[model samples]
Target: MGSAFPRLHVITDARPGRDALGVVTAAVSAAIGYQTPDALAVQVRVEDDVTDRAAYEFGLAVARICRPAGVMFLVNDRLDVAVAVDADGAHVGADDLPVPAARAVLGPAAVLGATCREPVSARAAVAAGATYLGVGPAFRTSTKAGLPEPLGAAGVAAVAEAVGSAPVIAIGGVSVDEVGELRARGAYGVAVVGALAVAADPEATTTALLKALA
Candidate 1:
């Protein structure tokens, strides 16, 4: 509620052998360089097997990187780590805490995000105090397994229209090239893991993403 939620979310790729912190740092630096730090948000998402202590340490580092740069920092599926690290807020998915519960943990004034794949869920999430809606597999993604088939743009539009003004952030397989199409289809923004996490030049990729959003 302090400021509008960011349009471009750089979700940490904590897959085995990936440098989550390094990717977050690079993304933050890129946001700062563009002089639109506030337009980018960093979400720290580690594997379920990751201990709370490890998640906290990582979230703390990301918060440190994002705070001074004016970028919002959120922890995924770990409200404890979010509160422990004093993150801007937390993001909750189906298997995680409910939107109301997450909002309760973060309290008022914190940015709360909830994942919803369809219109009914999207409306319910917004009604339950979600600050934004993470809606997708707008396209295919290998980052997370066991997801239903990609929603594509039409599915995202249905969710977006249902939620009204609540920002709909299209996730899964999001890339710079698809940003415009997603936005045109009523996606307020996008959340990405592979696009930047595996990029040869994160800064350039970030720049392209921001430009596409614009």
Candidate 2:
């Protein structure tokens, strides 16, 4: 990737019964062990029904883990909690605040991310001060429902071409097997939930994801 943005984004899985913190612990540990901590970003994404307090607590835990390991930490769809926990940044989707508004909330130096699917939205988001673009549902996913159809490698290429140097992180249904093609198609990175969360060995999976991106 041309930018400093991490190539592997390990999104938190906060669904009921999911051990989001445990998964993060393992992933972060793996990143440090590989001496490539900066190549990984951990994004905390809690369910909508969860309380703000709960989100804050989770963000705090993740921050502690990431900060010491020198890994980037971000919160999804919750700027307030991100600020409260002093996260590295936040990611906003269509339903959340616009990219400009999110930039205002996070301030000029924060690493802001905006989710977009096409060239138009991608261009607008970068113009509005997004540090990177999360462009996908790159493939079908069971983690988050009601997402638009998966944007295959070609779709990622379209947004990447439009944005020039801004890093495009291909999200949703991403896995080790798909990372190479996504990168070949112009995706700067890939974001995942189940790929690591449900894996038999999260640390190993994290390493594998990083290797694939390489």
Candidate 3:
């Protein structure tokens, strides 16, 4: 799964006119049809208010959607759900489980992702067994609240440099237009939420995002 990181990662979210699972299906279907499933990973993330049962069901559905296509399916901040659903792994933020704890829960083979905004945290995350880093709020975003200031492209570059071999995935307010800039700045890839969730045509939007990365 070395090539699995540094690819397009779609994080699920619900907003007006957007069915999170629907958008995920469309985006993933498009990626599979375009022969880029290997370049896609979907993280099952719902609002904090959602019940664990609901998140677990959603994770199962996403796993079913991704498994056949060989796309990695991950649960956000839910190690139990990830394990129960047999997902590829789990993604954790600063407020969620600590890196080593998450690694412990998921064990050595699971793909553990950690969020990092600066060099020190990036190093700590890597040392704690994070397979990859989600470095962001690359630009201001509404998808997540109380995020620190946006880390622009240069900020992303700095974190990427600090992380060395570990993949740095830029997140928060990332759009198709910003993918190239992020990649050029040494970001392995991006984790998107609002951009595709609210898109009028998510399939086409996914296609455009992949093209940009290409």
Candidate 4:
């Protein structure tokens, strides 16, 4: 109904080696090569085994590029890491720290996003304090390995209904062909990982995804 955040979260397609400092930086640099920073939200999930110090260092490197483009750094499940690196925001999941706790950690102005698989999850997220809600795995995909069962358009609608005034992002196995249908279903934006990250031309791939959204 009113202005909220825009869509376009491009998940990092690769995982950094457990202890390799260069791994995260290289992966992010490659992503920068794929798409303009501000044009897309770059969501990174630093492996659990990595130390907060390492994650912070990696985020700093990412910010060097992302901050320039006005691109948002969406750290998954690491509120402190986001704060430490001055990230644009933090995206958490149902299983992670609840939205209220995350928001409290980030302060009121910080962006906080939560993953919602069903209507209930969506409602709880907003009630707790998420600035936005991420809903899906709209279709099956390998990127989110071992995620919950897929929630197609129907699930998307349920989340949207719960969102009411908040923006909702549809993530998971979305492809070029599905963009129109997904957007038509009320998704405020789309998130992808392997689809664009694995493509031969990331720039072209990103152009196509943006076009799909339009």
Candidate 5:
């Protein structure tokens, strides 16, 4: 899982007239075609209103799509669903299970991602067994409401430096254009949502992102 960190992380979201699974599948398919399957990972994150059963079903479908391709599939904030679907891991935020509790549930073999906005929390999360830290909004984001201010490159670097070897995934409103700066600032990788979801050409966008990461 540590080796899997710092790769491109594509988070899925269901939007009007758009198929979340379709977008994720397309992006992952394109990514694997462009690079090694390990070069990309997908996190299945639907609306909060969607039921646990629905989430589990979605996770299963995504896992099926990703596993065969060698891409890691994770469920956002749903440990139960992740386990039920045999997902590679789970991503938990501040309001979700504490890092220790999450690690306890997923065990050492599974990947556990914790969200952090600053250095102190970053260190704490790593201490609690978080495999990686999602630190952001690296830029202004409209995907999630009530997010704190963006943690520009310097903020991301501070957290990365604080956590030492733990990978820092710059999340929130990330774009392909910011990849170089983030890599230069010590960010291990990025987690993107709206960028690929709304892109006119998702496969092309996925290729561009992978190229930047390369």
Candidate 6:
């Protein structure tokens, strides 16, 4: 992916189990992992509800394969596994541990993300010290069951406005088709799951998204 900011995060889901999602993760990592330092930020996600083993595998795979400067492990409701693996970062939602608590566990160097479905939450996340705001359901995403209603392009703009200077990452259901809208709306980046995860070629999918965003 030829992202201008060189940032592209790929979150994985266990909702479809290993065979389907695993292949995507592997391909995304291999595809964009070798770009020069200033050209890409690749993250491999291990989203699990109970079994932490998948998270562990995802973290190691990211380190070994993606070899990215950072890897954000989406801790749907757990942070311990993310810490144990020393993942590059952690993305937590409002229902999970608060930002301050996550920061404490993650330490200063570890990036902490907050999922802000609305502007109010986006403001609060910035006030609480989120490294970045995950604002989305830019479309309807089934990767995370019971996800908040679609944010659409307008929702993204609203969150970006609330964040002030903090960077905003549009996530949830975003696809290559919507990159231009996301950028025009002022999202610093985008986080994708199903689009790239279930693709026939993960690397190509990831690259295509980056190109679109650029």
- Taking all chains together, each candidate's TM-score versus the true structure is 0.97, 0.97, 0.95, 0.85, 0.96, 0.83
- By TM-score, is 2 or 6 better? 2
- Model 4: lDDT equals 0.73
lDDT for each residue of candidate 3 in 1-214, tens digit (9 for 90 to 100) = 2355538999988544569878888988889777888788899887888788988888888887788878888889878899999988999988898999999999999899998989999999999899999999999998888889999999999999998989898999999989989999999899899898889999999989888886
Colliding pairs, model 2: none
Model 4, position 199, has a per-residue lDDT of 66
Which pairs of residues clash in candidate 3, taking residues 3 or more apart in a chain or in different chains? none
Show the lowest summed lDDT stretch of 10 residues, model 6: 67-76
Off by over 4 Å in 6: 1-6, 16-48, 68-77
Which candidate leads in TM-score? 2
- TM-score-wise, the better of 4 and 6 is 4
Q: Which stretches of candidate 3 lie over 4 Å from their true place?
A: 1-3, 15-17
Native-vs-model 1 lDDT? 0.89
Worst 10 residues of 3 by lDDT: 1-10
Distance (Å) between predicted and true CA of 42, model 4?
A: 1.5
Candidate 5 — which pairs collide?
none
Q: Which residue pairs show collisions in model 6?
A: 1-207
- Which model, 4 or 5, shows the larger lDDT? 5
TM-score of 1: 0.97
**Total colliding residue pairs, candidate 1:** 0
Query: Best by lDDT, which number?
Result: 2
Model 6, total clashes: 1
Worst lDDT window (10 residues) for model 1? Answer: 1-10
